[model samples]
Target chain A: MHSIPGRRLIMGLFLIFLLLPIYWLVNMSFKTNAEIVSTMTLWPHTPTLQHYKRIFTDESWYSGYINSLEYVVLNTIISISVALPAAYAFSRYRFLGDKHLFFWLLSNRMAPAAVYALPFFNLYSAIGLFDTPWAVALAHCIFNVPLAVWILEGFVSGVPREIDETAFLDGYSFPRFFIKILVPLIASGIGVAAFFCFMFSWVELLLARTLTSVHAKPIAAIMTRTVSAAGMDWGLLAAAGVLTIIPGALVIWFVRNYIASGFALGRV
Target chain B: MDKTVNQKAWFLVLPVFLVVAFSAVLPLMTVVNYSMQDTFGNNQFFWNGVGWFKELLDPSTDLGGRFLASLGRNLFFSMVILAIEVPLGIVVALSMPRQGWTVAACLVILALPLLIPWNVVGTIWQIFGRPDIGLLGYVLNAIGIDYNYVSNEIDAWVTVIVMDVWHWTSLVALLCYAGLKSIPEAYYQAAQIDGASRWAVFKAIQLPKMNRVLLIAVLLRFMDSFMIYTEPFVVTGGGPGNSTTFVSIELVKIALGQFDLGKAAALSLVYNLIILIVCWIFYTVMTNAGVERKVQAESEPAAKPKSSAALKPATALKPKEGVA
Candidate 1:
C-alpha cells in the first residue's frame, strides 16, 4: 500500500472541515447573548450556565422536550409494529404483486413530505385530529412505515429459511415462530429500524410546526416560538438546540456498533 | 421460499397497511378533492374542474412563475448536491479505515450532523453565518468579503447548498462505505499483483463494484434534495427576492401564506408527478442495470479464480432480475 502523506493531509483537512461548524455551534451555545452579537469571540470570554439554567427551569422551554418525547415514542411504536410483518412478508415469501407492491411502498418514501403537508393539515383538521400528539404520530407513519418496511425487509431476508423451518418443526405456529425465533434473530435489524423511525420523527419540523398550535407540538416546533416576548432568546434557543442533540446523539451512539453490518444485513 | 400461501399472514400485514394507507392514501385523496374544488370561507366547495391547474400552469401568472422558478432551482440544487456529495462521499468512504474502532468513531462523527433536527441545523447556520457575530461571517468580513446570507442571493444559495451538503453528505458516504466494505480483499490483492495504478484500480474495480449502492445513494440524494424544506426555510426563508426559493418553500407560501387550497393542491399534485416520474426513471434504470449485471456475472465464463474472490460481495447477492 502507498504511504501517501498527501492523502493523510487531505483526510485530516476534511475532518476539520466537517467539525468546524459543530465547534462553532458549541462555542456559541456557551457564550452570553451580548458576546454572541457584540464581539467576535471564537471561545466564550465569559461563559455562563445561565442558558442551560433557563432551559431547565423555564416552563415553555422544558415543555418542548416533553412534547417531543411523547410524540416520538408514539410514532416509533406505531411505525415499527406495522413494518415488521410487511418486511417479513416481502423478505420471506413470493407473493402476488410482490414486486409491484414493494416498489410502490418504496415510491412512498420518495414523495416529498411537502406535497402532503397541506393536505394532511386539512385532513387532520377536518377529522378533528389537529393539534394532538396522535396526529403527529400518525402523520409520521407516512414516511416511517415505508422506511421501516424497507429496512426490516433487508434484515429479514438475510435470516435463512432453515431457521423458520426448524422452528415450525418444533411445533411452533407461524406467529410463535416469528415472535420466539425470528424476532430474536433479527433483533439488531429491529433496533436499527427503530432508531431510524425515532430519528426521522424526532427531527421532522414542517408538519410538526404546521399541525399543532401549542398544546401538542414537538420541541422542534416549540423552538420556533422561542423568539417571542423576549426579543429572540438566543441563549435559551442555543441551550434548547444543544439539549435536543442529546437524545439523538445517545440513539446514534447506541446504534453505531450495529450500523456497519446492519445495512449489509439488508436492515438499517 | 415455497409457494404454499398462508392466507392468515395478511392479518399481520393488515395493521401496517391500514396505518400507512390512512396517513398516505387519505391525505392524497384529500389533495385530489381540494384540487378539483374551490372553497369560499363557508367550508363549502364548488366544482372547479381543472381551473386551478389551468391557472397554475399559465405563464402570465406569478403563481406560475413562482412554481416554475422554484422547480428549476430545486432541479439545479439537486444536481449540485449530487455532484458534490456523491463523489465526495465516495472518496471519504474509500479513505476510511478498513477496520477497527477508528472506523466506528469516524462513522459516528459523520452521522452527527445527520442526527440534528433540520430546524436546528438552520438555526446553527443562521447564527453561525452572521457577519456581526457568526464565526464564518466575521472571518469572511475580516478577510474583506462582505458576506450576508440574509440579503445576498449568491450567499443565500451557497449557504443553503452548504448546509444541505453538510447535512446529507454523510448518508452518501455511509452508503458508499457499505459498498466498499463489501468488496472482497482478493480483488485488491490481484490489483496489487498486476501493479495497477490507484486510479485504474478504483475506476475498474471499485466503481464498477459499487454500482448498486451508488444507485441507491443517487436515488436517495435526489429524492431528499428535491423535497428539501426545513433547513433552507428556517435559514433563508426563501428570501433575497425569492432567489433561494425551492419548490417546497413556494408550495408552503401558496398553501399556507396565501391560503389558496385549490391551487396549492393542484401545484402539489404537479410537483408530486415530477418527482414520481424522475424517481420511476431512476428506479427502472437501476433495476435494469442490476438485472444486466446479474446475467453478466452468471453467464461470463470463469475469467480468473483470483478475480472471482476479488469481485464485490454486494454484487454476489443482489436479486436476479425480479427478486426484489
Candidate 2:
C-alpha cells in the first residue's frame, strides 16, 4: 500500500485520543477515594486494589458479571444458530416473501431498544421469564438475530453455490451438509457473526436493565444502581468499569486478525 | 449469483422468523395497544382512542412540545456526529499502518471504546469531565478555558458530542479500513503509473472503493446516534436544564420515569417510524449503488478487460447484505 504523508502522526494522535480517557478510568480505579477527591493525579499516587478486592468478595458485585456473561453467551448462541439457516436461505434462494422478510428483520435491528423495553418487561413477566437470564437473552435476539443473519448471509454468499450442489450430489443430507461441509467452510463468518452478537449483547443496557431486576442483573445495571445507592465511590465505579472492558478486550484480541473484515460484516 | 426460485427455503428461515416474531411482533402489538388507550391508576383502563396521538402531535400540548424539542435535538446531534466523525474516520483509516505489529495494536486500540458498555462510556466521560478531579476538566481549567460539562448548555452539548465521537468514530474508521483493504494493489499501481495526483487518486480510486462501507457506516452511525440514550443519559441525566435530552431520553422519562404509558407508547411508535423511514432510504440508496456498480462492472469489462478481473470480487460482494 502507498503511504500517506503524516499518516503516522495522524494515527498516533487518534490512538492517544482513544486511550486517554480509558487510562484515566484505569488510573482512577487504582486510587483510593480520598486520593481521587483530594488530588488530580495522572497516575495513582497510592495505587491500591481495594476496589478490585471488594468486587470479588461481594456476591452482589461478582454475580453481576456472571449474569451478564450468561445472557450474552445465551443470546449469541441463539442468534447464530437461528441465523445460520436463514442466512443460507437468503443468500442462495428466492423464497416466498424473502425481500419483505429480510427488510423486516433489518428494521428490527434498527428498532430502538427503548421502544421495546416496556413491552418486553410486560411480555417477559407474563411469560414468567422476567428477571431471568432467559428474558434478557431472548429480548436481545430482536436485534442480534437480524445482524447475525445479515453478516452470515454475506459470507455464505461468498461461498460458491457449486459447493452446495456438490455436497448434495455426493449424497450428503441437508443437515449433514450444513454441519459437515458448509459450517466449516464459513467458520470464520460464524465467528464474525458470533463476535457481533456478543459485542452488541454485552454492550447493550436499556433492554437488559429493563428485563432483569435482582436474579439476572447485568453488571452494567449493577454498576449504575450501586453507584446511585452507595454514592460516588469513584474507585469502585471505575474498577467495575475497568472490569467490563476486559471481556470485550479479550474477545477482540482473539479475533484481532478478523476485526476489520468482521466490522465490515464479512462483505469485504 | 443466480438464485433458484426455491420457496422451500422458507423452512430454513422458519427458526429466525419464529424467534424474531415472538420477540418483536408480540411487543409491538402491545405497544400499539397501549398507544391507542389511556390508563388510569391501577389495572383500570379505558379507551382513549387517538387522544394520546393527537396530544403527541400537537405542539401546543406538553407532550408534543417535549417530543418535538427532543426530536430536533436528536436530529442535530446525529448531523453533528456524522459531520465530525465521517471525515475524521476516513482520515484515521487512511492513516492506518500498512503492515506489521503496529497494525494489530492500532486495531485493538481503535476498537476498545466501541466495546465498552454504553453507560460505562457515559460514566467514563462523567468522571473524566468533572472539573475537580478529572484530568480533562482539570487541565482545561488550568489552561484558563473555563470548561465544565455541568452547569453550562454549550459545554454539556460539546461533552456529549465529543464523547460520542470518542465512542463511535472507531466503528466508522474500522469499516472504512475494511473497505480500503479490499481495493486491489493494481489500482494503486495504475494510479502511480499515470502520475495521478494524491487528490485525483483518492477521488477516483480510494473513495469509490470505500463507498459501500461508507454508506453502511453512515447508516449505522445515524441510526444509533439518533436513538442514543444510555451515554448522554448517564453523563448529563438530560440535565443542565434538559439542554441535551434526546428523544430516547425523553421517551424513557415518560415511559418509566413518569409512567405515562399511553404517551410513551405513542412517542415510541413515532420515534421508531422516523428511524424506519430513514433506514429505508439508506437501504434503497445502497441497493441502487450496488446495481449501478454491477452495470459499471459489466460495461467496464467490454471497454477494458484488464482491470475488470481485479474489480470483480469487490463489486460481487457489495450486494445482498444490509446494515451490521
Candidate 3:
C-alpha cells in the first residue's frame, strides 16, 4: 500500500488536538478550586482527590450517575428488542407502506430533541410517568428505535435468506427461529445497536432534564445545577465531567474493532 | 438478495410502529395544537389560529426577527463545520496506519471525544478556553492576544465551532476509513502498472470508492450541526449577547425559559419542517445512488469475481445496500 507523506505527523497532531481539552479537564479536576481560579499551572501544584471524594460521598452527586445509567439501560433494552423484529421484517419481506413507514421512522430520528422537550414533559406528566426513569427511556425511543432498526437492518441483510428457510424446514416456529437460530447470527448487530442506544440516551440532557426534576436527574443535568447552585466549584464540576467520560470510554474500548463499521451504521 | 413479497411482515413491524407513534405522533399533535392557541397564566386558552405562524414568518415581529437571525446563523455554522471537517477527515483517514496495534490505539483515541457526553464536551472546552486559568486562553493571553469567549462574540463563535470540529470530525474520518478499507488491492496494483502518480491514484480510485460514505458523512454532520444545542449552550450559554444562539437554543429559551408556548410551537413546527424536507432530499439521492451502483455491479460480470472476493469480508460483516 502507498503511504501518504507526513502521515504520522498528521495523525499525531490531530490526536493531540483531540486530547488537549480533555487533558485540561483532568488537570483541573485534581487541583483545588482556589488554584484553578487564582493560578495557572501546567500540572496540579498540589494535586488532591477531594473532588472525587466529594462526588463519591454525596448522595445527590452519585445518584445522578445511577439515574443516568438506569434510563440508558432501559432505553437500550427497549430500543433493541423492538428494532430486531422490525429490522428482520424490513430486511426480508415486502409489506404495505414499507417504504413510507421506513421514511417516517427515519424522520423521527431527525426530529430535534428540543422540539419534543415541552410536549414530552406534558405528555409524561399526564400519563403519570413524570420524574421517572421510564419517561426518559420511552421518550428516547422516538430516536433510538429508528436508529437501531436502521443499523440492524444492514446487518440482517448481510445474512443469507436460506438460513430462515432452513430453520423453517426443520419445523422451527417463527419465534423459535428468531431466538434460537437467527438472533445468534446477528448478535454483533444487536450489540452495535444497543451501544448506540446507550450512547445517545446517556449523553442526552434536554429531554432527561425536562422530564425529571429531582428524582431521576441525570449526571449531566446535575453538573449544570451544581454550577448554578454552588457558584462554580470548578474542581467538583471537572471531576463530574471526567466521571461521565469513563463509561463511554470503556464501551469504546470494548467495541474498538467494530468502531469504524459501526460508525457507518454497518453500511460499509 | 431478492426478498419475498409477504404482507404478514407487518406483524413483525407492528411493535416498533406502535412505540414510535406513541412517542412521535402524540407530541406532534400537541405541538400543532399549541401553535394555534393563545394561552394565559391560568391555563385559559383562546383560538388564535395561524397568528403565531404569521408572526414567526414575518421578520418584522420580534419573534420572527429572532427566528430568522438564528436560522441564518445556524446555516452559516453548518456550512463552516462541513467545509472544515470533511476534507480534514478525508486527510486523517488517508493518513491512518494500515495494519498494526497502533491502528487499534489510534481508533480508540479518535473515538474518545465522540463518546463524551455533549455537555461534558462543553465543560471541557469551557474550562480549556477560560482566559484566567485555562490552558488555551491563558496561553493566548500570555502571548498577548485578546481572547475571552465570555465577552467577545467572535471568540465565542470560534470556540463553539472548534469544539464541534473536535467532537465530530472523527465520525467522518471513521466512515471514510471504512470506505477505503473496502477497496480491493488490485486497483492500486493496476495504477502502479500504469505508472500513476499518488494524486492520480487517489483521484481515480480512492475518491470514487469514498463517494457513498462521504455523502453519508456530509448528511449526518449537517443535520447534527444544524440541531446542535447542548455544547454551544453550555460553552457560551448563547451569550456574548445572543450572537452564538442557534435555532435550538432560541427555541428552548422561548419554550422552557419564557414559557411562550404558542410562539415556541410555531417555531418548532417550522424548524422540524425544514429538517424533514432536507432529510427527504438526502434519502432520495442516497437511494438513487444505491440503485445506480447496483445496476453497474450487475452489468459488469467480467470484473465481478475479483471485486467480490476482495469485498467478501466487509460484505459478510456488513452489506452496504441496506442504507435506504
Candidate 4:
C-alpha cells in the first residue's frame, strides 16, 4: 500500500503510451480525407460511419475479413489438435531423445518466416494447396504447433499422474480415460494456447498475402488493394482496421480471466 | 503412482512429429535444394554447389554486403528494444498492484496491444505518426521539430523503434509482473524485519527470483525483433533509404521483389541459422540460471505449498478427459 502513489503514476504513464495509438487510429477512421491531409485535428469534428459502411458494402474489402477468419480458425484447430497428444506424451513419458525432440520442436519457432515464404509459396502452389485456406493454415502450423506444444506441455505436466491411473483403474479404455479425465484438468491451458494460436495466425499478413492473390486474400491484403484509382481511402481503411480488432477483442475478453494464471503455469 | 507410462507414449507423439516434419522438414529441404541450385525460369537448374553461399559470405558481393548490413541493423534493433523495454518493463511490473481485480485489469490492458496483428500495429503507427493529423506528429511539429517518417531516415528509425517498444514492452512487463507476483509475502515481511530498503529488497529478493523469466522474456523479444519484417515493411516499406530494413525485410526483398529463388533460399537459411545460434546461446544461459536458482532457493524458499493448494481443491475439481 505504501507503493500506491508510485504505482498510480507508473500505470497512468503506461495507459497513455498504450492507448495513444489506438486513439489516433479510431480518430482517423472517422475523418474525411480532406481533413486528414489539410491539418491535424485532435478529434474529428465531423465523425461519420462511412468507412464502416464501405467495408461492409464493398465486396473487395469485405472478403478480406472472411478469408482471414476462415484460415485463422483452421490454423487454430489444427495446431491445437496436433499439440495435444504431443504435449501429453512429453508430460507422461520419458522416452528416448525426449528432451532433444522437444527442444528441436521449439527451434522451429525460431526459424525466420521470411526464409520459408518463398519455399512455401512455391511448394504449396506446386501441390495445388496454394491460394486456399489450408495453405495458410498449414504454414501457420510450422510455428504455432511448437508453441502450442511448449505451453500445453506445462499444463499437462502439472496434472497429477494419479488422475490418469485412476481413470484406467475404473475400467475406462485409454481413449475414454484421456477424454474423460485428462482434458478437463488442462482446459484453461488449452484455452490459453488456442487464443495465442488464433492471435498469431490472425495477425500474420506477409505470408498470407504472398501465398494468395485473389481467391484467398485476407482483410489485411484487401486493405493493401484498396488504394485504387480513387486514391487511398483513409476512412475505409481505418474502418476495416477497427473491425479487425473486434474478433481479437472478443477472444481476449473471453479468455481474460485465465490468461494471467495460465501463463504463470506455463512458465513453470 | 507408477513411474512409467507404456511405450505407447511414442504413438501419441508420432502424429505431431509427422505434421511438424511435413510442415518444417520438407519446406526446409526445398529451401536447401533451391539454395544450391541456379535456375533461370522454366524449372531449369544448374548445380551451383555452394556458389550462392560463398557469394553471400563474401564481403565484396552486393548480396553479401546487404546481408551483413541487414544482420547488423537487426542486431542493433534487438539491442535497442532490450535496452528500452527490459528496464521499462521492470519498472511497470514493480509498480503493478499485487492482487485483486486491479491487477487483472492492468494485465488485460497490457495484453491488448499484444493481441493486435503485426500489420495492424504498423498501420496504426503509420496513421498515428502522420504530421497532419497524428497526435504525436502534430505535437512534435508544434514543438518546432520537422517530422516526416516516410521521407526521413532518422524519423523512420525512431518511429519503428517506438512502435516496436509500444507493441512489445507489454510482454516484458507482463512476464516480469508474473515473476513479481510469484514472490511470496514472507520475503517482504522478512525484509521488513531486517529493515531492508526497497532497493535492497528488490536486489536481493525480487531480482534473483525474476532472473529465469526475465531471461525468457529477453530471448523471445530479441529473436522477434531480429526477425521483424511485417511492421517496418508496412510502415516504411523498409525505406527512407533502407535505414529501417531488418533481416526479414531483406529476405523478403530478395525472394519476392527480385524473384531470385536461389539467393533468397541461401539467405533464408543463413538467417535461420543465425537466429537458432543466438537463441540456443540464450536458452543455455537461462537454463544455467535456473540451475543456480534451484540451488539458491533450496536455502530460503518462500511460502508453504498451501498457497498453491488453493488451485488444486481435490474435492471441488472435476475429472477431465478429452483428446485435446
The sequence of per-residue lDDT tens digits that candidate 2 reaches over residues B144-263 is 999988899999999999999999999999999999998889777655545555666677778888999999999999999999999999999998998999999999999999988999
For model 2, name the residue pairs that clash.
none
- lDDT per residue for candidate 3 within B1-324, as digits (tens), equals 677899999999999999999999999999999999989868988899999999999999999999999999999999999999999999999999989999999999999988899999999999899998789999999999999999999999999999999999999999999899888886676555455667766776788889999999999999999999999999999999989999999999999999999999999999999999999988898889978988877877876766743443333223322221
Tens digit of per-residue lDDT, candidate 4, span A119-147:
78878989999999999999988889998
User: Candidate 1 regions off by >4 Å?
Assistant: A1-5, A261-268, B1-9, B289-308, B311-324
Pairs that collide, model 4: A64-A219, A179-B321, A179-B322, A180-B320, A180-B321, A181-B320, A181-B321, A182-B320
In order, the first chain's TM-score in every candidate is: 0.92, 0.98, 0.98, 0.95
Per-residue lDDT tens digits of candidate 1, residues A1-268?
3212265565566677777877787787798988877878778899988888887898887888898888889999988888998888776766666667667677787888887888788888999989998888888888888889988987887788888878888899977887888899989889989988888898898888778887887788777777788587776677778888889888888999776554443522
In candidate 3, the residue pairs with backbone N, CA or C atoms under 3 Å apart (3 or more residues apart, or in different chains) clash, namely none
The reply for model 3, stretches above 4 Å from the true place, is A228-230, B302-324
List candidate 4 stretches off by more than 4 Å: A1-5, A263-265, B1-6, B285-324
Candidate 4 residue-wise lDDT, B203-288, digit = tens: 66788767877888888898889889899998999998978888899988888898898999999888888888886787578658
What fraction of native interface contacts is shared by candidate 2? Answer: 0.86
Single out the weakest 10-residue window by summed lDDT for candidate 4 chain A: A1-10
Model 3 chain B is weakest, by summed lDDT over 10 consecutive residues, at: B315-324
lDDT for residue A201 in candidate 2, whole number 0-100: 98
State the weakest 10-residue window (summed lDDT) of model 3 chain A.
A224-233
Error of 2 at A239 (Å): 0.5
> Per-prediction TM-score of chain B?
0.89, 0.93, 0.93, 0.89
Score each candidate by Cα lDDT: 0.80, 0.91, 0.91, 0.82
Residue B110 of model 4 has an lDDT of 83
Docking class of 1: medium
Candidate 1, position B120, lDDT:
91
